[model samples]
Target: MNTYFITGIGTDVGKTVVAAIVTEAMQADYWKPVQAGELQHTDTHSVEELISNSKSVMHEHSYALRTPMSPHAAAAIDGVHIDLEMIEEPETENHLVIEGAGGLLVPLNEQETILDLIKNNYKVIVVSRHYLGSINHTLLTLSELRSRGLEVSGIIFNGKAHPTTEHIIKKMGHVEEIGRIDEEAVIDKQVIKKYAEMFKPRLEAL
Candidate 1:
């Protein structure tokens, strides 16, 4: 059972969407360890709704905060501390899809960042969405992962295809282009299933 840790260059880069695709593709269990806000419509709930696979199980978050902010701030507001050691991964026999918040450097606590939550065994998938200055963000993300000696499986581009941006990212980062999620009008279960099928081959290869 492979564990895919889905991260992004920055916030709103579609990590949850890509995580859904990968989870559906692999029929994997889903987990979001530290959700900062939106307790009503959490990432775990969103992925559960998006995926059509019966094999995928939605795991409870390790830390569910009330405020919509970084985990550290949210935890503080709630009068608690996020201990990385206490943030345990759910025990799952199936392939697990772990969606991260914001970006790699986002603080989970005063001492630890989001990067600290990713275990060495998990295959990292950096979700890169094209925007101005995205190239630098993408490269820096990959560089940090490399420097930490984390195993980066590849990148999943999320948004309209930008050949030049994609070209540069692939060439410079030297990471596999696993697959991409094109701009979708409505990302329903059917749409998620479509992208699941499209990404299955490459995901299986990983």
Candidate 2:
């Protein structure tokens, strides 16, 4: 079974949307691992709403903190300690999609970051949104993953494309452009399904 770790350059980069699309595309089991905020409308809930496939299973989060902050900070505010040992990956026969919080270096605890949860065999998928200095952020994100000897499957560009910025990122980052999620006013299941169909081929090719 293939495991895909969905991460982003930073927060609000559409990691959850891309994760839902990938899960719908592959009909894979979905796991968020760690959720910091939006407990009433968590990433798991969002993905569950977007998914149309009946085969996909939504695995519970290892840690669901209440405060809308970094996992470590959120845990602290909640009077809880984030422990890496306690965050065990769920076993599944189908493909698994794991979503990370914030970015690669987002701390889960004093000793470990979100990157620690990624195992050697997991394929990393990065979600990048174009903005001022995004090229730098995107490059740095890819560089960090590669430096840690992680296998980055490719990148999913979110929102409108910036030709020059994307050009430089693709050329320098040395990562395939899995697909882009165009700016959508309303991203319903139909919209997600549309992108899922569009991204299915490339994701399967991975």
Candidate 3:
């Protein structure tokens, strides 16, 4: 089973939403290693609620901090430390969807960032939402993944379309454009399922 690690150029780039689509598309198990805050309503919960597939299982997080901040700061406030070695991946015979917090360079601890959580075997999917200066952010993200020798399966654009922005990023990054999640009035299970079906073909191709 292949693992898909969903990351983003920066925070609030709709990583969780894109993750839900991929999870539903592949009927894959879902896991978010470290949750900084909103313990009652975490990324794991969001995906679970959004997906309609019975095959998908929600895995527990490695660490759940009390504060809503970067993992390192949240860990410090909670009097804990994030050991990358201790952040183990859950076993699954089917594909697994792993979602990261914030961006690639966000710190999980002083010595490590979210980038460290990604294993070499996992196929990376970068989620990008258009915004001013997003071009630079997206390019840098792709560059870092390439430099690390990680397998970047492709990208999933989220929200309203920006032709020029998407065009430039696609041209420069040279990554697969897996699919896009158009602006949704309400992203319910139906919406997620619709995107799931649309993305399934490309995801399987990967």
- By summed lDDT, the worst window of 10 consecutive residues in model 3 runs over 85-94
Give the per-residue lDDT of model 2 (tens digit) for 1-206: 78999999999999999999999999999999889989999999999999899999999999999999999999999999998889999999999999999999999989899989988899899999988889999999999998899888999999997888888899999999999999999989999999999999999988
> Can you write out model 3's per-residue Cα lDDT over 15-93, one digit (the tens) per residue?
9999999999999999999998999898889999999989999999999998999999999999999999899999879
Whole-model lDDT values for every prediction:
0.93, 0.94, 0.93
Off by over 4 Å in 1: none
In terms of lDDT, model 1 sits at 0.93
Ranking by lDDT: 2, 1, 3
TM-score against native, each model: 0.98, 0.98, 0.98
Deviation (Å) of 198 in candidate 2:
0.7
Q: Quote the positional error of residue 99 for candidate 1 in Å.
A: 0.7
Instruction: Please report the TM-score between candidate 1 and the true structure.
Output: 0.98
